[model samples]
Target: MQITVKLFATFREGRFKQADRDYPIGTTVANVVDDLAIVPSEIGMIFVKGRAAEMDYVLKENDALALFPLLGGG
Candidate 1:
């Protein structure tokens, strides 16, 4: 299956803002995160096809996944 990943905030640092990634069937959001070298702790929110999604959420072909990093500010 092919998924489109969008990165936000620090998540985009050194990485692309968006990308098209291919994965085997039954792949989950966590798999893509790991493949991108993004630690789970760094993730604040995840959206799959514009809806809030869990890390374990299964990815479907052509799914649009967005990742947001934990934000810190005074």
Candidate 2:
């Protein structure tokens, strides 16, 4: 299945802002993050198809995913 991944903030540094990737059926959000070399601790939020999703959320074909890194600063 093919899915779109959108990166935000620092997450886009040295990486693309968006991409279309192919993964096997039943692939989870965590798998994509790992493939992108993003650690779980750096993830602030995940959205799948515009809805908040967990790392264990299964990715569906043509799904759109957005990843945001943890924000800091007072």
Candidate 3:
């Protein structure tokens, strides 16, 4: 399956802003995060096709997955 991943905030520091990547049919959001070397604790929000999604949410072909990093402000 091909998934489009979008990274936000600090998540794109050393990674791309968006890209289409291939994964197995049973791949989940957590799997993609792990593959990108992102710590789970650093994730602030997740969206699949513009809807809120969980880490264990299974990805489907052509799904748009967005990941946001934890934000801090004083």
Order the numbered candidates by lDDT, best leading: 3, 2, 1
Candidate 2 lDDT over residue span 1-74, tens digit each: 99999999999999999999999999999999999999899899899988999999999999999999977688
Number of the top candidate by TM-score? 3
TM-score of each: 0.92, 0.92, 0.93
Kindly report which residue stretches of model 1 are placed more than 4 angstroms away from their true locations once superposed: 72-74
Highest lDDT, which number?
3
* Span of ten consecutive residues with least summed lDDT in model 3: 64-73
lDDT of 1 by residue, 48-70 (tens): 98899999999999999999987
Candidate 3 runs further than 4 Å off:
72-74
- Native-to-model Cα distance after best TM-score fit, residue 57 in candidate 1, in Å: 0.4
Q: How many collisions between residues are there in candidate 3?
A: 0
**Model 2: lDDT to the true structure:** 0.95
